[model samples]
Target: MGIMGCCSDFLQRVKPYVAMISLQFGYAGMNIISKVSLNHGMSHYVLVVYRHAFATLSIAPFALILERKVRPKITFSIFVQIFVLGLLGPVIDQNFYYAGLKFTSPTFSCAMSNILPAMTFVMAVLCRMEKVDLKKIRCQAKVVGTVVTVAGAMLMTLYKGPIMEMVWTKHVHPHRSSAPETTDSSDKDWLKGSMFLIVATLAWAALFVLQAVTLKQYSAQLSLTTLICFMGTLQAIAVTLVMEHKPSAWSIGWDMNLLAAAYAGIVTSSIAYYVQGLVIQSRGPVFASAFSPLMMIIVAIMGSFILAENIYLGGVLGAVLIVVGLYSVLWGKYKEHKENKKSKVMSLPLTLKNSEGNGEGMDIKDEDEKGKKANSMNLSTSDDRSTIKVRFPIPEIPMKVEAPNA
Candidate 1:
């Protein structure tokens, strides 16, 4: 039982780490698969609509079943929050991210997304959800880590060095037939895609922050996820109707498009949202976003395998920096959490002592009052003896007679 308890405790501690890491793999797969679907000429707007629709369908049943009892009643404010969440995530983030993926390689898109942690940290700080005390070493670590992570992401974006070949990718070569077309249109398209990715990332960061706030009210993770997906489905449909007029774009017939929508909906939207909400609830948005760099790494490797994408030395270097910064932030968070627990534990004795001291002081005050009353009574009795002596003056008598002698 003791060993089992220890293992359980350990698992609870590591669960967030494991969950976020696993989420990165899911996100990596989504990026690659979604990129493929986009390359196959699926409309990004329509894809967003289908993705959230599928997400709503896949997760609604579980949410209804699992959260039927615990789900909080949605008030008007909560409904508004859910609406904004849908706008940020499914409509803005998904559409922009898909459009970005269309113009850029999955690896570059993932690399660009490494900026999420920094953005989230800043927003969290601004929203007062995260604390920042420059005097504290842990706070300093987090600040520095966020800066370094952003710097690394920028370095990856601004600089591309010689291509780096992996052991498994030595013989893998990009097809030459598409090279001329890519070279012709790569510069402007890549710039546009980077802009889209940045916007998407900003929206994604806002979504995290808002989701954290929403959870405070709603509390039910599955229910909130389903609501977000459902709302997003509605919002995305409106956007898709305006942006994609061709009905043919919406037609799905068992291809990568269908696979992309279904997989992203079930895995990334439904499961990912629920898990991320759990993590964000347990830790803050910063910790939840901290694992994004891992997704970049995973996508880098996977993109190389699936897309035969070239890996650059600058990207490699930037990834190392990002990982270092990620660990720094995590260490700071751990230390801060540990210090908080310690402070709470240490404060317990002081609080008890304070209460005890107050009780003792009251007792002492009562005893002091009783002592003063006793002293006053003694003085009064002395005064009464003096008054009797003064009023009926009894003199000292000389006793002369000895009866035994007589």
Candidate 2:
């Protein structure tokens, strides 16, 4: 039992880290696969439609089975929040993200995405979900981190230094869809792509804030994800129909598109959302968004080999700044968490002392003395009418003498 308890405690401590890593890997895989699918002429709207349709299907079973008993009643207000969440997430965020990827490389897209932590931090503070104590080092670290992260994202978008081309990608065709092919075109398209990604990240941050708040009202993680997927499917389908009039554009078969949709739906959309909901419930939106840099790193490494991406000096510099900023925010949060724990630990002894308010610390003798004092007070009040001098005040007995028989 003792060994089992220790193992359980260890696992509890490690669970959030494991969940965040899995979420990052899933996101990295989705980005790579989505880029490939788009390169093969998959429209962003059509992809969103298929992605959420499959996500709904994948998550429905879990929502029905796991949350069958414990799920709360979904009120009208909750439904509206979830609907808006779908719009910000699958509609605004993912769609814009995919469109931006079409105009830019996967590595650059992921690099720009590193601002999510800062964005979430700012939004969370605005929403009052997070507190900012500027006097504390934790708050200072977070402020500096947010500034550094946003600066890194801006540098990544505006500056593209000479290509630090990878040796492994030498065999891949130079004209592949992985890169924009020229600095001239890249400059123009970088602005366009950055605009879209900015919107995507904003929507992403808004969704994080909304999801965190909504989860407080509705605790069922799987059900809420299923609802988001369902609403997102409808919303995406509507948008896709209006934008992509040709039925041929929606025609998907046994190809990379299908594979991408399947993987993204099940792994990234469904499981990632479910796990993130749990993480947010345990931690918060900022903590969940903090792991985004890992996704950037994974996609950078994978995009180099899979998509034949060229890593540039500007990209490397921006990546370093973003990573440093991310750690700064995390370090601040860790320090704040430690201080909070310390405060709780210190307060516990004071609470115990206040509740057990004996002149000395509580013991068996103190309890016995209390009982004897109560009995003596009863006898004195009943038989002997005299004054009593009390060092420690008693509520029932007066400190001054009150001679009732006089």
Candidate 3:
């Protein structure tokens, strides 16, 4: 709470762009750390349950202390919305993402996540929550960015080419006739993992669209995050109980298991969720969305350095495309921000000039005092110039679309 308070105060004094970069790195750290935990053999189901548990516990205190009075009363409709959010986000998203990692590799899963922003954009557009101006550069950039990101996701998932063996020459000796290649591509789990991760990315993207709409009706981001975590805790616990009740899956007496669970619960769930909420509050959801691809880069680098994971050509090309697409969207956003600033600067003079002429006293001769009395009598004169208006930056809450019940 103290850290968050400091962050909020710092953000108030600083620019939003600096806050955005900090958020991107924080999210990237979660991915890299989660990958480390997954490699330690934690069950995805357990991880999901523990994550929600930790998150609920961490946030519930704040909800009680800070938002007790103003918090919206839980109603049947809100319950339904909470249920949907729990199912889609922490339950489905976390489960599938971790399961995908189990079948494939963390690098693969992280790479696939880069497509989320593009998917969200499409979902938002389809729901009429976002408008597109094909002629405008900003809209054009967004459209192109979305297409590029999708293409990158495809490249990452579908194309697994021959390893560029040279990349690992310094790290390991090349296998010759004396030694067979260690990797076994015939494993069915790899393909299954690849497919599952793609599905996970799509599910997460859908969840983002729903959450965006929900945020509109519910202005309290922190409160909404807490509710979702609490609901997800219940949902995950139920599913885990049903699925892992068998005697074989019930064993939990191992250091690795406990460590993995703790990592997922404390670091990934509690800390990451708080950071994400701050990001969404400080920057708009779209800006946060565009940072996903950059997180993949961090994942790839960390995986290579820490776990000695092999990098593939397809992964490289896919990462490049994702970066290109992400930057395109970011560039467009930067341009829009600059344009708004320029527009406001231009409008400032007009507003001041209008104020000076209409509100402030205009220079008049004493001889015209007689005429001034007559002119003042007609207060609502024929002079229409008094009502000059100037445009400013667009306010937040662009449109009315509830975050998805999912």
The most accurate candidate by TM-score is: 2
Pick the winner on TM-score between candidates 1 and 3. Answer: 1
* Pairwise lDDT winner, candidates 1 and 3: 1
TM value for model 1 = 0.78
Question: What is the C-alpha lDDT profile of model 2 across 150-186, one tens digit per residue?
Answer: 8888888888888786655565655544644676776
Q: What C-alpha lDDT does candidate 1 achieve relative to the native structure?
A: 0.81
Residue 281's C-alpha lDDT in candidate 1? 82
Q: Which lDDT tens digits does candidate 1 get at residues 200-311?
A: 9999999989988998999988888889999999999998888888989989989999999999999998889779878988987658866777788789888988888877
Off by over 4 Å in 1: 1-21, 174-184, 276-291, 349-406
The number of the candidate with the highest lDDT is: 2
Q: Which residue pairs in candidate 3 have backbone atoms (N, alpha carbon, C) closer than 3 angstroms, thus clashing?
A: 84-406, 210-403, 210-404, 213-402, 213-403, 214-402, 214-403
Question: TM-scores across all candidates?
Answer: 0.78, 0.80, 0.74
lDDT of 3 by residue, 286-307 (tens): 5666666656766666666666
Which lDDT value does model 3 have at 197? Answer: 77
Give the local distance difference test score of model 2: 0.83
Score residue 354 of candidate 3 by CA lDDT.
24
